[model samples]
Target chain A: MATAVAKKKKVRINGCVAAAQAAKYADVDVITAYPIRPYTATMMALAQMVANGELDAEYIVADSEHSQLSIAHGASSSGARVFTGSSGVGVQFAYELYSPISGTRMPVQMMIADRTLDPPGDFGSEHTDALSARDMGWLMGWSCDAQEAFDNHLLGFRIGEDRRVLLPQMVCQDGFFVSHITTDVELPDTGQVQEFLPPYTHPYPLDPRRPVSHGPQIMPEQGPPLQLERARAMEGAVPVIEQAHDEFARIFGRRYDPWLEEFMTDGADVVFFVQGAHAVTARYAIRHMRERGAKVGLVRLKTIRPYPTDRVKDALSKFKVVGVIETNLGLGSVSSGGVLYAEACAALYESPTRPLVVSFMAGMGGEAIVLKEFYWMTNKMLDAQKRGAIEKRTHWVGFEE
Target chain B: MPAIEIQRQMLPMFPSPNQGARFYNPELPETEPFVPGHRTCAGCGPSIQYRMTSKASGDNTILVGPTGCMYVANSSYLCTPYNVPWAHTQIGSSGSFTAGVAAAYEAMIRKGKWKGAFPNIICEAGDGSASDIGLASISGALYRNHDCLIICYDNEQYANTGIQASSRTPYGGMTTFSPPGPTIPEAKKLFPKDLARMMAAGHPHCYVATASVGYPIDLMNKVRKGLNHKGASYLMVYTPCQKGFVYETPRSIDLGRLVVECGLYPIWEWNPEKREFDYSFRPQNMRPVSEYLKLQGRFGHLHAEHIATLQKFANEQWRMMKVELPAALIRAADAKNLVDMASAEAAAAIAETV
Candidate 1:
């Protein structure tokens, strides 16, 4: 579909810059911005890009995060490719627009550079800000590194803008970890990106030529069907995500597992389960543990929404123990620790051989999960596997004895 | 790359309704963007304003309705009276959504994605949204100079939420939240916000004006003029609420005129080019505040002193407009000249019990 194949190049940039580059390569038409730390870097890069005439897009500095998302919704409703984002409490401030945007089925993309929510205003990475919006019918996932963050943004637009999957996407990365850490990212040629992601076109935009009313008040009886249709759209995206990842692999010469990226699980008895930037640390920890003749491996989850329940069950059934690293706070959750443990245990409940699952609160407060902490979590998982049962369901990685 | 040509639409301005002494309006646009058969009251003031505004903007328009009576009553049971494209936004997302639509057209037209003249983007916000919750968002849209019109159909209270007080609720007005009490005898103690002037003062680049549903031709012309303005514009039109104001349904338009005549609602425009107020628009006659207050039951509890307070407030508004006040209008601001409302005693007795 694309004719002008430019040369591909690699650049050393942070995750925020990678997101800006992805938006540029995708040829986004409208971008709404409101400054909040770490996500503000993305908007800064975009502002310069627009000024340099590298990207011809309508860049609006919205009054607030609420206005930012509202602008994105409006632009997307008018059949424009929109990109907007926030961090920390900025994400929570625009909480009201999440359901409305998704309910309208506008495939607007938001890049969330994850940051801690308030109570003293910490600017570290935390999943609670984005996890709070998981039930709002948006496609959500996390990227572990700058390169994956770049690839995920492109894949998010391609999949979310698909006709069958017209839901918004929150492509999340850690605040200072991936968002600030510079890494070598292989930027794609414009022709390759154009071929993968087509020009955005909604079936019914707010066009005067083709008049249509959107989001009118519906009767109580007519409510469920619309909600059911939204549900169907989200569920239908599972296959489209797989197909897009396949196409991405074929065209970009980069292959990635769509659901889980298992490393060193060939002959392992226990595994560390993680998402986002902490997985990069876990992989190094796994290599160190293997050299000491430990049977620990790593399983990094790529997508969390439309969560891969069957794949998680099948993969974890091979392990004796699965340690879920939660960089988020679930204050009064089921395991009395983090929220991921409950989801992981629920998915493995139907598995024939369920692994003894435990949650590890590591890499919290935007602190990196050092190799020492990862090794401590592996030892705790090994203790659970050897005893054939767990002591407590959760461990504060740095705080526990 | 060479500069791309962007095609813009310039709508023809309507002729003035006053043709010598005839007082007959000219032919209006035939495109009925807002049709009948929706569930508004018998003589809904906002519904009347919606009809006139859409009629002026015509077919090439996109209407954004934030959460209000216009959004709820006009689009009920999955049916809408709007024949043109309409989208419902959150109550606080009034300006931001309209800005998004305007920006989308700016980019889409320049990029050759959409092939047509830019559509008129209008946000119909209520007084509650315009003066209170969504104020900053509207200010942001205007400050950014988006090519759109933000109209605050001022009904004075939160009419859709069963009559509560908003920042635009006039002094001495009584809604469910602002009921007359022994301690608070005047019902609502605070004066209504000067919303339109505030818009003009804050964003001097925007064309800001005030109109009423009473003057249909003037209101329609202002709507067109706002649309014709090259940048963002604001209009705060007074639309009397029959349900909230507790008035007879047929007097909706008459109440609009009486409010302006009594000096309770000022009509003027903020000329951005001259950076001054244009007060040439005048009502047919000057009257006391009672002529407007006596018609609505919300002001039925006003005593003689309270009436003087309201008259003094109206007189101050007249002074700000630089209108020459009549002796009779000035004399009416004294407590000795006015009498208590008919039900003032009984209302006070009831108020003391509650």
Candidate 2:
């Protein structure tokens, strides 16, 4: 069921600006942020929006990342739609609040422009920052480009604000790559956005007339029931996520697979399983590889939380081998690889005939996963399929002897 | 863009504590925000302070209790005693979390999103949390002028953690962490920080005040005044810790009164409207420092010189409050006028073995 599209203006903007535009269009009630690289640009854009009077909202420059998240949580709990973000260790700095915000079921949206966590002194994009919090009861995913990042922010609001699934969302984009790169982003008409996403209101807000205790300390025995209810909300978000995406596509004419994006899996013997902007490069590499009569494709993971176990199992089952491009750091993992390898391998563990899965640590430290590296990773997977076994479980793509 | 409408609250600006001269129950909101059947001690000062604060806040309130006795004991085994909305934040997040709640309400109530009068957002932090780890965050909240109230329920030391000495712990006071030892005979070497005055000096615009659980009506009134200030406010209440102070359970409120009377805890308010410190508060029946110190076992180890040192400290507090020191208090301020702790036998007999 599709509807007539609205007037869309094509504007060239960076990923940070795209996210700020999405936040502005969403008409967020409160925006709180602390300065961290890559993600700081988004706040800069938003601050300018507020300064220019283009956005009528409360923009608070928090003392720290912890305060930013706290402000976001408080604002959200008070029945205001709030937007805040951090990058790198800035994300880790606010680690204590991730659960409290989610546990309370306040739909706070955090725009994460992934930056390399420090000690290495790099400002490139890496998934580890947001990936580390994937299990913290937040709905999270990545966008390949600015347009998707913008669209995802809108979809995130709808999905998270739904009564059935009132959870916070992490709209992540790669640092510098998607966040800094300028592209032609189609801005939706304000009326169309209004029709798609309306103003947010929490059912149990801290209202003088209707007061409710949120995140109250529960007894040990009472813990299980509340946790189970939170689990239920997450599990229930599956239908809500699917419905929102379907509705998002119909209204905005931008359709996306809410969970996993399949680039080319038709009759492929081997494929690349990647996430974020790395998948965009994987697409180019796969197109050239296919022209060489190589049966290779790409399986880009969009949603990393409430992980699409059944869908991943079905789509990846058709391949003979899968190369998991982990743009994140997951030390002591099953594949001695990245964390995504475990999720991909777990979904395939119960398969009738599981493919040979190999981990390739690439696109880390904000370094681009070049076409040659994709070729190198593809050959590793193809070699595994032909040998019917992985020579090794994980490969540090450029480090392998 | 449409003209953003300004919403004025119809709620009372300050708390309406019932006026009385005697120890009568202050007219409080009917709703028991701090319900009974909690695990705080029989005469826990902080628990009593919690009751008064929650009563002042009423139904439309959100309480942020940093990790402390109020957070752990009051909500023991997940059995919360709160009738109104309450949250537990990290010890250091006392002010930051409260600032968040206050800022949220500001946007929500003003943005035509949330309806009704603004709810009171209050943070109840322990002395250790407020005067120690949470000082900067509290300063930040006050500096930002968020519409919230930050109350440091000062039990003198970190009583919840088995009486570890905190920055607010008085000089010569004994705690698990500051026991009288060979090198440090006076127990805690330094004087207690003048926290309320520090907050008032740092955040002059805030409605800052020093209060005590001993005076229920005044404490509740100050709580209301802070909440009604329409901006950030800080209150530090002298909540006696029977467990830590090693006093009789029944004397918790009595200790609260003795503190003010002895000038150890002078009650005063910072008037932001006139940008002045209102030192108009006066305690009835001024007593010497010995009257307050002799009641607590923690100070029982103090010698004549130590007690006189405390008296001197109390004198300083009175001077800051602009109160003339009484003759007995002035005499007690000198070691020569005080007995040598019965020639050191009391110090030897009362020194905690720990």
Candidate 3:
């Protein structure tokens, strides 16, 4: 629905810089940063923005990501729109804060340029970093490209800061795929962003005049009610997310399905179920395969936590087989390794004629699942449909048998 | 003095109902700045300190709980207990976060984003969080002179993560990691880091004080004083943990008094403007270190020598505070004079042997 609006200005920039530009356009009030690869450029851009007087904000170069989030948590509680980002292990390094920030309902937004977890020390796009934190009460999702990344950053603020949702957001994009890649991302004017997202104001913020104790110690029996409240909030966020996206479209001329992005899934015999930049590639593969008259499609999951199980089950119920592409490491997990396989299988367990799903370790270590790999995965799915069973639990896309 | 006239007032024969020892939770506004139903442990002493702290700050207050037990346990499950606005900072970000909150309020109030008399910005940090991880950041906030109050609830050990020895943990105390064994007889051999005094000595321009929960009125009064101070103020309060201290829950406040009376923890304030220590406050009685040690299992393993060493340390603390020790206290400081486990033979030895 986005229209070409009055000859857009073009600028050459990387993914990190684009994210920084999005944060700048969002008019973030406080920026907390700790240097880590890929995502560091975003903070570096913000630092320059602060220095050049392009952004009138408090730029805090924190000692660590733990400190960075704490600063953001503090700043946001003081009613400032805060921006922070981390990459790979840097995200894990700050794992301690994920729940505390959300629990306090500070609505802090963090941009994570997904990097492969260490052991081999590869600085590449992988979902393992952010995926590890999916269960921590944060609104987590990944963007497929730079424009989506930019849009997601703004939407994340809107969704997280919404009174009904009041949760922290982990807006992720692949490290090199989206974080380093350059693309034409239309920058919304400040007025449009303002209309799309209101200035964050918590009802009971750390205001001295109306002192409230945030995150105080509670007894054991008291824990369930609070957790139930958080659960209710997550479940309640469905309509809010839709309304936010609808509002974003009305104001910014960019339309997005709040939950799942489906491509040629109607009447498809097999579908690729996945998230992030690889979904873009899968879509391309789907198009190529469809041209050859092989009934194939893609179902890109936009939101992971608050996991959209009902919508996913509805979408994939008709398909004979579903291939799950996992760009993450699940170490010793079931389904021969990847985590999404478990999530997808579990989500489909109660469905009528549940699809024959096979886990594909296609994007492990950030290796791009090439066109051939997609075709290979699709063939595996097709084989499962025809044979009524899968030969193996998982298939490493690029590596030989 | 007129004893007859004093008696004519018909005071209660026992401790009077209105005596200083009695606790009356101030006629606090119905507003609960720090509300109940948090994730803190049952009978948590530090949480009690937080409750008292926020109650003193009242409606117009911003609380900053740095990363520690308070931030973790209290704010768990995304349900905050704060009726007012409270934020959690990193264990090390207490001072800096507080400074930001204070700065934000100053700018907001001035810019008309908010309109009110400046709210009391208070940062409540645990001893481990404050004295150890957060010391430099707190020092930075104090040095920057932010209009805030930073209270280090000194429960000695890190109680939230089970009992662990913090820099503020006293000598001869037994923590999980600092257990008493045959070789290392005195569990924690090193003396506690003189944290509050160090804060006062380092940040002389800021209002610095040491308080205990035993003196609630004094604690509340100090909270008000810190809020009223034009610049940053630091208060390291002795809030005993019944769990970590291995004492009866009801004795939590009692330990606070015993800690000060034993001279292990001194209660005083530093007058920034006058540039002097105010030793105006005093405990009711001076007691031996054993009186405090006997209450907690952490100090149970200490031998006579260890107790004497602690007593010597307490004597040195008394001297630093310029408190003139009585002869009894000086006699209590000597190892030989102090009663050992088998020392009943010294006097009144006509005992039936088991």
Q: Which candidate's lDDT is highest? A: 1
Q: Write the per-residue lDDT of candidate 1 for residues B1-354, one digit (tens) a residue.
A: 332456766777677651111224447877789999999998899999999899999999999999999999999998999888999999999999999999999888888789888888999999998999899889999999999999999999998998889999999988888998778878999998889999999999999999999888889889988999999999999999888887889999889889999999999999999999998888889999999999887888899999999999999989988989999988999999999876767665533432
The number of the candidate with the highest TM-score is 1
Clashing pairs in 1: none
Q: Candidate 1 lDDT, tens digit per residue, A1-401?
A: 11222479988999999999898888888999999999999999999988877888999999999999999999999999999999999999999999999999999999999998886468899988998898899999999889999999999999999999999999999999999999999999887887899999999999999999989997899999999999999899999999999999999989888899999998999998888999888888899999999999988888999899999999999999999998888999998888888879999999989999989988778888899898888999999999999878889888878
Q: After superposition, how far is residue B338 of candidate 2 from its true place, in Å?
A: 4.6
**lDDT at A219, model 1:** 85
DockQ of 2: 0.43
Per-prediction interface RMSD in Å: 2.9, 5.3, 13.8
What share of the reference contacts survives in each candidate?
A: 0.78, 0.46, 0.43
Model 1, residue B236: C-alpha shift (Å): 0.3
Q: Candidate 2, residues B112-162: lDDT per residue as tens digits?
A: 665667778889999998999878778888999998999999998987788
lDDT of 1 at B136: 88
Every candidate's TM-score, chain A alone: 0.98, 0.97, 0.96
Model 1: reference contacts kept, as a fraction:
0.78
* Candidate 3 structure, TM-score to reference: 0.78
Q: B149, model 1: CA deviation in Å? A: 0.5
Interface RMSD of 2: 5.3
